[model samples]
Target: MESERYIRQTILKDFGLKSQKKLTKARVLVIGVGGLGIPVLQYLNAMGVGTIGLIDNDVVSLNNLHRQVLFSEKDINKTKISVAIKKLKKQNSTSKLIGYKLYLSKKNALSIIEKYDLIVDASDNFPTRYLVNDACVILGKPFVYGALHSFEGYVSVFNHKDGPTYRCLFPNPPKSEEIPNCNEQGVLGVIPGIIGNIQALEVVKVIAGIGSPLSGELLIFNGLEQEYHKFKINSLSKNKKIEELKDTYELECSFDNSSISSDAFKELLNSSTEIQLVDVRTTEEYNDYHLKQATHLPLKSIYLNHNSLDFEKTIYFICQSGVRSLEALRFLKKEQPEATLISINGGLNEFRNYDAKH
Candidate 1:
């Protein structure tokens, strides 16, 4: 390790050379390289974390630029893992940066996480959060968790030294309709940075055995009002009883069987030219461009105006990406259980890509 590079940190009273050495020996695996993961990786790598692993299958898009500040218009369409690793290497050549260009699924979570000293749950979705929790509990590892929603964000360290796991805080995932992701709801570009930095600090504390980690306590930050709150998370024996990862981490909100690929969706359009299709995006997004013959309705409008929609017909939903469309499908499933609803997987982006290839 370059002692001069981290001299500022090494000179701290409690966090002296010993802590610096601990950081150099630590291996941390970050689950995503988007808005939150970028900051975590940057800080950890700069501070001399020995091995940093990032796993993500997503490609950079125009929308991602607003919050995932690491990527620019030039980097759009590039794989996030590759782009992040390339930039991070330039930031710190000494830190061993590893990139996994794939989504974290039940099949791979355990095998990958077992190799790391600590895991950083920088993922945006709930299923991944639960998967990280269960895997960490099973492998006897600790993980730092961070999440963002609009102007507010949450941070906590789970499964550290027999501490409370994420399941202890949330025993069950919320119903699909109860919570909307940042993609659907929207978030300030800076919120994830604030939350991510806190997560990185927690990771450092846990690794170096210095300050108190956020284990057994959840930190809530509201950027709008600039308020911070902490809630105690009581450990539950049942949560720590995981013997293995679940067969699948897709939550109740998932639209696996009910989702159609962009190519299949095109075939359906060709077969039935008059098929019902709805585009659930903001008015501005819909106004900018939309699929031909698609009815425009924002996500909240779908929830509020469900009575007007024809439940008798099989309705196909589309969004800028597929996120909001999935939310739309989930909402309608509860309101009209018998209604045949399908979300266009990968949404407009995938549809355009399909059009480009053909």
Candidate 2:
């Protein structure tokens, strides 16, 4: 038998053959292969969890190498799930690794997650978090939740034996503008590793039933201070039950016209050309390289300066990859629906790519 591979852990009084058998039969689905997901994948695989499913559609970038330990410069531009699989496979072949190039969507989430016994919320966005929580609640499956921003990271177990759900912590999704995500705020490379390891540890504990899980508690780690704090999340039964999955996720529900391709946006730029461009990226990003005549209005200050936006020209909002731009678009559309609106597809990434080719 492969018991030799787990001999060290099996020798522990609490985590012996019974726990190892539970781990060998357990099925875990990790939601993202980004910063948090990669580390989570490595540990889960090393622990010999049976049937680990990796779902991610994003590509590996040069910038991701610092924190996404499974990826390297050679893996740049490759699909993150694919790159992560190669590394996880090499780590341990005993664990059955399944790779899905698809992203988590409301339509398929229930079906995709139904097969797994546990869910790992390694996602970077809020809508996906809600989706996972709802799915877990609906299926009576527990989930390990991890999140990071700057030097801060959070880990929590939601819907574990009816303990507490994510909504118990935050009743509703914050207004898109109020939450500027890790992309806009930026994160130190090592923050996710710390939180992800916690998530991985929680997964092992929950699956093997070995220790006291953070069922109703949230663990916050400050890398700068190297301090850890645990806080209780009260059960909010008002919104706990989910009868049916919503057709739309709130992240994209507000902004239908989020972004367009660089080529199409370029055509809009040169022809008919009454575009009023606003870069929603930070000032530092704008100073680095930006469209020659575009105004540098960061997402944080957009609300304060929105009144000054030109109503006459067709507005084209730009950001790193149009995420912030779409957030801004939602705000602007609600504020100034009378104005013509458009978003640079792919944002500055497209702009740089076009410039490089031309």
Candidate 3:
């Protein structure tokens, strides 16, 4: 270890050389390389965390540049984990960086997560968050959780030393339509950075055995109002009983059954003028690029304007990725249960790929 490099932090009275040594012995795994993950990784690695592992199957896209600051225009389309690992290595050569360029699913979550001393839930979606929580509970590991909404962010440390798990706060996952993700309801660029840094702080505190970790209290930050709020979360005995991974953690939504491949959606688009295709991405995203035949109806405004959609025809929903479209389908399914609604699986990215090929 380079003592001089971390001398400033090591010099603190409460966090002396002993705490620095603890940081060096820590092994942390971050679940995403997106907005929140970037800051968490940067701080932990710089602070002398001995080993860090990151898993992400996503690629850097033009849209990701706004929040995922570690990536640049030149890195677009490159695998996130590979790009992150390469850049992080240059930042701290002494810290070991491990990259798993794969989505965290039941098949791989247990095996990979077991190797790390701490897990950071930096993922955007609910499915991955739940998967990480259950896996950590099963393995008796602690995980720092962070999530983003419009201009708001939340941070909490779960399953730490018999503390409250995520399920204690949220006993069950909300219906897809009840809560849209940051993708559906756009997030301010700085939100993740603020929340991620807090997560990093909690990680250091947990590893070094100093300061109170956010184990039972959920920290909520509102960037717009510049406000911070904390709510206590009590542990649920049932949540800690998770012995094994669920058969499947996929969220229940109509989109699962009513999804069509991009190729099939394209064929349907070409075949029928009667098909009502709606783009559920933000107006900016729709303005940037959208199918000429698709109507722009941002997911954030879908509930208010859903009645405008024609129930007589089979409506197809599309977004940058399949997530928002699935959320849209779920919303419409409740509003117009009799109407036929379909989601374009893989969304515009897959559509653009097939379009480029053809």
Candidate 4:
């Protein structure tokens, strides 16, 4: 009877009826219902995972539709967890699914984590990744971690049977500017799907105690070359015990918000009496379309041409999205400390959306 449900998986000797039973009894929590969380949630639910909890404070956006397959144009502006829950319920009515529409913080991390047997980190920010790792470590819960850049992705399972945490691999987070997010660099729709599925596989392995788990190992995938590389995570580095979870993880670590909304930019546009708009995206991106009354200043030439820009005027920086604008704003702020500067939230995408509606 169960064979029909997981016929392909049950055919494998490593994961037969015994493993399917374990999966049916497992409870898992997926944090961040973004690109990675979508596929991970779908496969786990389809595999007959008994209970699943999804946590996300963000709402779906037009840009997200390219990579986040679970959502559609209809889901735009709807809370991610709410939309995800409805879809998952339709996919599998038997699974007990829960959704948390609030952001994950230290205060509620442990409590939210306590109900689950395992956790999945699908967040893009560094602080949240660390916070999730620390909370999982303290709660003694295993977590499947995944992160993606332009065309590369990383997947690992941390704190499983005393394995190394994320910090053990990299004690310090990279400077915010050095690492560009999907908003700036752009990611292929298939990259996150591939990584998220691997994450789901690791979770199933952990739950069923079947095939070799990714614990103490990090798998890297390059979409450009379609190559996969596995490296042993340095387990002996230091397994720090997380005794307490703090309330404010963002304040302690760097978080990027270069993808601000056009509505937010419009608010600043209306409020500021004397602000100059600066567009730092590529010439082609700017030529494709841009905000009215904005000047194109490619990022590569910012240092050389910034001197020509009037320091007297308040600057409102913009880009294809918000990432380059933040970098531009930071550069201008440092060069002329007294000059007032602000980043146009969500860059041109938000601006175009607002303009089209009005």
- Collision pairs in model 3: none
Better of 3 and 4 by TM-score: 3
**Model 2 CA RMSD to the hidden true structure, in angstroms:** 10.4
- Residue 224 of model 4: what lDDT? 94
User: lDDT per model, in order?
Assistant: 0.87, 0.83, 0.87, 0.82
Writing each residue's lDDT as its tens digit, candidate 4 over 167-251 gives 7787656646767887888999989999999999999989999777888888899999999999887765345566876423553
* Model 2 regions more than 4 Å off: 251-358
Candidate 3 TM-score versus the reference: 0.72
What TM-score fits each model? 0.72, 0.71, 0.72, 0.70
Superposed Cα deviation of residue 154, candidate 1 (Å): 0.5
lDDT of 1 by residue, 17-80 (tens): 9999999999999999988998899999889999999999999999899888778899999999
lDDT of 4 at 151: 90
Better of 2 and 4 by lDDT: 2
RMSD values, in order shown: 10.6, 10.4, 11.2, 11.1
Question: What are the per-residue Cα lDDT tens digits for candidate 3 across 1-358?
Answer: 4999999999999999999999888899999999999999999998999999998999999998898889999999999988899899999999999999998987799999999999999998877888999999999999999999888999999999978999999876665667888888997788899999999999999999998999999999999999999999999899999998753455232235467767656766665677788999898888777888888899999978877899887888988889999899998899889988888888899876443211
Once model 2 is optimally superposed onto the true structure by TM-score, how far is the C-alpha of residue 131 displaced, in angstroms? 1.0
